[model samples]
Target chain A: MGLFSRLIAKVKGESGSQISASDWQELERALIESDLGVKGVSEIIELAKKERGEDIESSLTSALSSWLSTNSRQLASNSDRLTTVMVVGVNGTGKTTSTAKLASLLNNDGAKVVLAAADTFRAAATEQLQTWGARLNLEVVAGPQNGDPASVAFNGAAAAKESNASYLIVDTAGRLHTKSDLMDELGKVRRVIEKLTPVDEVLLVVDATTGQNGINQAKIFAESVSVTGLILTKLDGSAKGGIALAIERETKIPIKFIGTGEGAGDFAAFDATTYLQGLFQA
Target chain B: MFESLSNKFAGAFSALRNKGRLKSGDLSDIANEIKLALLDSDVAISVAEAFVKQIEDRSLAVLDDVNKSTNPSQAIFNIVNEELTAILGGSARRIRLAKNPPTVILLTGLQGAGKTSLAGKLAKWLKDQGNTPILIASDLQRPNAVTQLQVVGESVGVPVFAPEPGNGVGDPIRVAKDGIKFAKDKLHNIVIVDTAGRLGIDQELMQQARDIRDAVNPDEVLYVVDAMVGQDAVRTAQAFLDGVGFDAVVLTKLDGDARGGAALSITQITGKPIMFAATGEKVSDFDLFYPDRLASRILGLGDIQTLAETAKSAMDAETTAKFEKKFIEGADFTLDDFLSQLEAMKKMGSMTKLLGMIPGANSGAIKKQLEQFDDNELIKTQSIVQSMTPIERNDPKVLNGSRRARIAKGSGRAVSDVNSLVDRFQAAQKMMRQMRTGKGGMQMPPGMQMPPGMAAPAISKPVQPPKKKSRSGNPAKRALES
Candidate 1:
């Protein structure tokens, strides 16, 4: 059977005059299927069952949405202070692109933005940032390839200050949380950048498609750098980003951005209700 | 990260450990635990449910056997392990380098999933296996992607067929065709085509990847998924399967502390085999994915086999010969040797992953220590060695007060740190000399014996039966935990 038709059938079953014990079980399965995780799905079921009124679907959806949307999804940008945003995440999670997209957004909004390619370890990382910079008509501050990322971060902060840019976004190389030296290096990069300007936002970019592993990455990255907010990337139209709901609930870090597509302009401020709607939809 | 999940699975199975006859009800709790463990590892709920249900059904069938003499729990463990391995490792060793030249391999994945790195690693591996492999830079979407591929290819000593540098958003289809043709003409048997990935899987991105696949008509269209990828692994795999169907899945970044339970869902749901695993960032980190070994790893049986292979792989032939001549025949292990050993071990993987490979080293406290393992110790050691003069590196005695102070300053370390490093180096040298003279009967890990003089890491712990590989066979059935 088609997934859409099955979901519709399940929805119809849920709207019955009286919800049966099987109805709750079905509801539980539906939530789990949506990527809310076992923990999130169970808790949501309990919350919905306890506080649910006559309309079960609405109560559950609202519960899931409310819990996801509690975090204040705003970038730490102030008029007085230069916003130094450091982007970090696991390898292959669209960190550099997200950083550029954020920079593109700020630049379009008439904020002076400087891209700092602090991901000196990855091959052609600086060039990738430069290409993004060229496309957006912004300047990128890059260091030598395979050079000290900390120095590059320092230079980025310095360049932002020199150019009077509103935002200095430092794009770090994707390092696994399991690597302690890499984590320490990230911490060192932050400290180095802070020497020049206070790091306004330590944004942890997570792929929405990530599963239970997201929680572990979030917790570790958060512990290392006081990861202030999250950027959920690669959520173009996938149902699996449900792990984000669980991660959001657990880490308590609000997702500030959603990378919708590959295009430089495809990023948007995450709407919890809209995301939850996407999850519920077939 | 998998420790908790392993603990849950163990907790569930622990109930049936000493039971003489298994009741049908016993399978339920174990099944539930296995299901939870799978789900927690990020396996899709439906897939987890289906897998556990099968395990439950199989356990019941074993219990309802006519011959009540059989060990029901062992049967269940065997079934679970075999099924898990079947899903993971059954379809492995599938990459048959085309008998005809230009056996094209198109790699697809979400952006930043290490396609370029994989391409390099695959080329090196194929070359190591006596095949001429050339990399095709078909990922024209990302800026400087061709350059990046070229860089990776150069590092691996493989040639990369790339389009001329410009706005790299040139026709990837055209590039792919040209690359395949070039490999065919050059008589390179293996062609690895690296494609671009969108931050999100959009229509255009899919179309571009699809177009490249059609153009290449690759022998192997390997879907490279980051094992660290959580919930979205199955959906993404499904989308790729539908949009640009791949032959197999390659799990990358396994060395990363990934609860990549998504691998289970991808294999179980899509029926795709996880063919290869990229354990570390280096080109050498790539290896054949062993489902049996991985299943044992998930079950908290330490990965002794993979660990030994990692150590063995670290010792290239030249290094092995050098060690044999330098350490075994001529002299004791030097600071230079210590530094090189550190480099090799570091290349193997992160401390956490390495610890996971050691049998029973996954203790809670050790796992925690591994989390905070001063991985920088390798870098520090390297820097200290690099700071020293050649004479000082070859002979610890050469490192006098002035030299120690100078080396420490150069490496951005203190004199005390340098002194300690030298002291450790000397002690390690003495120990290696003793081992060379058979003073300590260090039991080398099985399946990893190589050329003489290759430093057999002091494995004081008992050599394990390679996770569950040996026990999964009939002959070693007696060794099953009673």
Candidate 2:
């Protein structure tokens, strides 16, 4: 797992010389395994080439880190008005469960929170949200099955405002990028929510195990709603260490939180040092 | 996306075709091109590197001959295609029907990986193959997870065995054990245990999954993986392999725009075969995973095997025969026939996705037409066509202004709707007549040229080589002096 040493060995251990094809190839391998796409890998390799025997680690880290924000990675916790965090992602990425976890995180912090079961598409999705709410002594606002998700968000906004809650996390339905009509409909859902309060954080929940195909999904969401952040879920500890860098580089969206487990308390803000250390860890 | 790579292969082959002999270094460009395509297709980085290396070695081997007279590119494609097929585990393996009754299949994956849905699909798929399957709702962790599996079970026409929550919470392992017992008592030959999934991998979840594995000692423990999980596919697979080793992997959500990298990486990473792939939401939309077919699809070569299967399932012999007779006889293609074909196509799933498999079907016009086309349009078309009298349906020209008005009134559609149907039917009939008379400019999908000795009919089927052989007839080898 000495991912760091392997990355820097060719530079630190070798005599000062121009980076050779083999060195570039090895770096490319590392980048690709990191879930960085072909486009991003080539771009990083080109950047690392200029350093020669210079501090290649920082040069490359900076290149990868440049896509993420330099500011503190925190949610919209301002006490001005209700700060709504709208969670969205394609199906099977744990969007619904992550919503529950996010609610729990906020609840644990003693922030008044209201959950909006805006995903009316799945048959038992609302009940799933309610069950999570019941565990934490929180209430979930939901609408009828196959109802307009935007209206559900609207109802949720009303509920949050009436309770004078500090935050509202709206869980939207899982949809694919290929369906333009549905993608466009997501935009409508956002505008509907924005009417009540700013959607300070529209986190696109992605599975850590997802490959390069997820980049396309993220790109679409970013383009449509200006996705503010990413939430990496299902990180049950594996080599998916590369995707974090690739997604940040591709989507230019900072990863805000990661779902470490299925429990309501398994989420945390993404720390750059810990993640970078993890990449070189194993 | 693979289409671009397919074109690149054509370019590379043509470049080699012009050269009299294969230079060892000439394959470097093709190797890089193929590598980029593999990465784009979601093949893991290290795995893609290894695969490209294999192709490079194979290509150089084809050039080893001194009297070298061969289509080197064709030889390279065969090698590359063969290696890709082999990496995908060669062939589809059906579910292992245990010698003893009550074959238990434990389903496990991260939350939202479509485990519950796959359980229902597996149960239905088994039933279709003449086996009784019962589902066990052991995913008690997620609220309503049990009820969700129950709903899926009812939809698939399979009975669900859910242990009532004891003390407000029942251990998943206990539920799994009791479910198998219930299956034995009820004589349900197959017991599919749908286990709980955490949003992420956790010690507690894995411990429970492992406990269930030990308790049941199931014949088939299938890890249901989402095809959309690209790079994460291998890592998650490795974790599951180590935590709760499974017999096979079940890929779900392939109907989405899956680059198919995870599907490619899982088998290699875990040394397990992908036994089944569930495409759409329907229980019937699942099939045994065929590596060769998937290879062809990934190569941007249309999946004729899948197309044939989809067609065969959707169309009865009588309907196909009637269509053939009408085409051969140059008979007018009626609205009724068009209605039936439309229904068949809709049954096959997304028109846009299906068209990707057919040569020359990825055109903008066709995609646009499919996007505009919907079930409502089909229903309206059906209503309009069905409203026509026998004389009008058989001979639409006889459908004058009065007949059209009467039919529109009967169908509760506008006069324009009826008029549009007749016009569209006439246009289609003209196209069919031209194709039937051999005057139509019909472009067949490449690799699917009409087989010699098989007369061209309106519906053209690709020359289906034996599925197991996987395009073994080498064009490059044939050109070489063996």
Candidate 3:
């Protein structure tokens, strides 16, 4: 057995005994070894220690579950009526692909949806979004690749208002989150969309394989615009998916969805309980 | 790695290196090389085209730099690497959370992309970070999806709030809203609403995800994707991002054999930092994404962190200490030690990544082949060793006809297989003995040069003609020639 598995087994074998500080330390060590990150391990350890005198396994599990539920609840309540979501991220991070995927997912759930390709950076980005729009047979507003992204977003929102579309998804240029000018451009787009229609959401498209760096990028993008949620993609690679823990711990942002494959149907909503179960299982 | 793409990269690099310098003719060749590599690796066509244009422009501007460099090949390599990295975005991103309690997270994805699995993974990740999370099973279409969420919830010991399974589709979203309220009342900080996944992207599904976004006002909406889907994954992610305005991406199944081209291209296409990765089915297998580590792995420079982990798992301190002591004393260089080292190597995932880790292992086809050998075969060999009696294992001479038959039966293999194993082991032992004695009898095997920085080459090289492609389009020929 690997060192991590061995440690987990050692801890699990002693589940019935009174938990000691050392045992908690071992568990924390195991978590760190598993790539849970320092912040996550310490947070879990502190919560586990609060129930030191109780059933160790149950307490640890409950503490973890409660912690996850608490974090997710914070994001859940922030969603309000006419919540507009402005999706922005760097190019090739599945920005355009994710836009179509998200549009299909929302449309399936019976929401009035409209898509706008405001990614005026690439010549074919608008066409790519248009292709998905055709497949879904949904209305799409698009501009030339080198045209103004903010203008496209404004026009798209105006179309949404005209059609009384319940949800308007504005696809923006894929720019570096660290680029102040690009980030400022995102702010302009968000403001323009809100002027046309109430902007309810600003979602950052993040690749799951980026680890802690993904979290750092999200922070910068969040600062630039009113980023309300996270959309993590490409789950079927070599990346360990540890950024999920780091992002929540450091940024306290609720992860809304996960993309497991290239299919349009590969997305699913985030569930803390289910996530914990998958995390703890061997 | 995906076999086809790996071959393409190898072929492209070889061709580029052979040309020695950048020229207008080299532009088409480079573009074609890159196009084939990206397409074979499953990068979206549009993205690939844009990348090629950018590379072409950059390459033209850096012609002087390439011409002036001591090694033109290395210079080109740097240019390609730099451009690829830039297109993928130079850094990662974090999420935005509201200051208030009860932040809602709307999760969306297609069916069979491990959306449910990711939901569980995300929940555990959040909980470990001190956030109180509640799971909302809003996927009312798929049969047993609710139960699946509950099963995951029960496993994590977290409460799963969902409408009764028999309820209609819309009911789940309503319950999700109510669950969010309940979680808030209970002092929970986050509510993750796990939505249903469809077989394909359609208007209905997009509406559902958007409806939930409208109803819950989630702080974040994450789109889940499977990385193995390659270019398809990138395309799907874009579609979903447009529909729901998801905040970030959660990639799953990173441990699979996917070339991970999608991961590289996705960031460039979306301008988003990959937030997290699901390496294995186990919850602990999740990790935050790192572009540099991924780039290193892709470039065939083995990931050090993964390598360290493998070593820690496979090598005990006592065994390492013994090996170290023997190396220092110059007395531990035995055939037995070599065999044991081979055994330890079997525990790592593959020979390819390991070989790539060693100095000078990246030069030739033979080295690549050795690295890519099947781990299952190694396991079979390991089992064969286990089946042998201690005497037969330690002393190969003890394995006569009767013993060989017995061993074959124990290992459930043909006697021929057993004999072959013994023969290979004996040949290896003989080679080691010859090396230790420092006799003129010792000579390195063909294609076994000890890398440039290591010990001096022990054998004269053979002059072989450059192999041409066979009519069959066999990649082995191309690889061997390169």
| C-alpha local distance difference test of each model | 0.76, 0.74, 0.63
Model 1 C-alpha lDDT versus the unseen true structure: 0.76
Q: What TM-score would each prediction reach against the true structure? A: 0.84, 0.84, 0.49
Question: Per-residue CA lDDT of candidate 2, range A149-174, in tens?
Answer: 99999889988999999989999988
Model 1: which residue pairs collide? A92-B112, A209-B232, A210-B230, A210-B231, A211-B230, A211-B231
| Decreasing TM-score order of the candidates | 1, 2, 3
Better of 2 and 3 by lDDT: 2
**What is candidate 2's lDDT per residue for B1-482, written digit by digit as tens?**
34434554555656766776667777787788777777777777668778889988877766665225456566676787788788887888888888999888989887778898788888898998899999998888777888778878888889999875421378888888988888899999999998887433577678889999998889998988888765657767887888898899998887766667777788877879999988875678788999997777555456887788887988888999998987877787776677687677667776555656775433444334444434355456677878887777777767666777899999999876665455445545555666777885674433223221111212222322222134223433311211
Query: Which candidate has the top score in DockQ?
Result: 1
Which has the better DockQ: candidate 1, or candidate 2? Answer: 1
Give the lDDT of residue B76 in candidate 2.
71
Cα lDDT tens digits for candidate 3, B304-396: 766677667677778788878765664634435544665667555454444445433444554545533444555555556667876666676
* DockQ value for model 3: 0.01
Better of 2 and 3 by DockQ: 2
Give the runs in model 2 whose Cα sits over 4 Å from its true position. Answer: A2-25, A49-56, A69-74, A77-81, A191-200, B1-20, B64-70, B164-168, B198-207, B321-331, B360-395, B398-421, B431-482
Residue pairs that clash (backbone atoms under 3 angstroms), model 2:
A34-A242, A34-A243, A209-B232, A210-B231, A211-B230, A211-B231, B42-B261
Ranking by DockQ: 1, 2, 3
Candidate 1 structure quality by residue, lDDT tens digits, B412-445: 9987666545544544555566678887566432
Docking class of 2: medium
TM-score of 1: 0.84
